[model samples]
Target: MSFTQRLRRRLFPPRDAIEGYENEELVDTICRKTAAYQGQANWPLVADLTTVLDFGGGAGVHYKTARQQSPDIRWAVVETPAMVRRAMELATDRLRFFERIEEAADWLGNVDLIHSNGAIQYVPNPVRTIRSLCAVAPAKLIWHRVPISEGEGRREVQTSYLSDNGPGQAPSLAEKLVRYERTWIPEQAFIRAHEGYRMAERSPDPREHGTYQFRFVPD
Candidate 1:
């Protein structure tokens, strides 16, 4: 990992109880809303006897909700190590957890649906990742990502490089905020990246957030 990535992981550890609580609530709301929408859309194609791959699924909140909504479907939750542990603790036998994408990819050939919400944006090469998923799974892909927009802010915090001796001088705020930029995938760029896939639906989030959902069938 790069210096910044290492620092980010340490400072803002992936397992933040407060943030996880809030995120779980938000994800639950989104899942319920999306499930209702999909139900009304008459997309009964995969309603029964389908396998779901919840890629980058944190805490498996969506996986639980989806399983309840579609009891017949098999579910797999793929997330980071910390998150996989948490999900495994909460998940049922119908839902399995994988700590790595490669492990999830191994089962992709058997999946009938791939779902990723607010996760692909973190990927360094989302196009390649999506293509890999598509290669293994020949089925519907439902993905949501934060679209590139203005007025986004990124900030970093720094503390003294502590030692056992005593206290050290703290880093300046200017030194702390090393990198700040809006990180979002443009809609056109995303569409172009998955051009071979047939887009079934495109909808902006009702909350007026920069997030968007694209439901498509892999070619």
Candidate 2:
């Protein structure tokens, strides 16, 4: 496995602390906002969408919010085993869960949409993966990823909490956002790899952190 994949497996171990906090209302709100933005940008395409594949779907939170926004939409959450189990527990008829992307691929001949949030950064072959997914689903692809930029270090510090102090005992939030100073791919590289896709929009996070939203469509 690649370093990125290994890091994800370790940091986001099946049912870790982060998983426990995923169902919070704030998380739900953010997901809803993201889905709304995607819908607006790809409104014409999504209007006819009935089934969607939520790739790297974490605990089915996004799926839940998406269902509320589009009741006629059916969804399948594709994630790692740990997340898959959590999703199954939260599953409804319109929302199902799968552990592998290939499993979901079998059910979708040409899906209307693909929702991928905060997951592709760990993919070793992002270009190939994107192409494969796009080939299987020609409608629309909404991918959100963290951008690597200059001035930040690539190492992230993580803290482990030990037992029983009061609420005050909780450790300060570890700086998990590592800056990949030299790793930012140039726009040309993105254009080259993502051949048939046109850059519809590029929105950078206002916090000065390197996260960005690049909306694209197949040419």
RMSD of each: 12.8, 10.8
Tens-place lDDT digits, model 2, residues 48-109: 57888887666555554555556677787776565555446556777777876767767655
| lDDT of model 1, residue 118 | 69
Task: Give each model's whole-structure lDDT.
Answer: 0.55, 0.54
For candidate 2, the lDDT comes to: 0.54
lDDT at 82, model 1? 57
Clashing pairs in 1: none
Q: Model 1 misses residue 156 by how many Å? A: 11
The TM-score between candidate 2 and the true structure equals: 0.59
Question: How much is 76 displaced in model 1, in angstroms?
Answer: 1.1
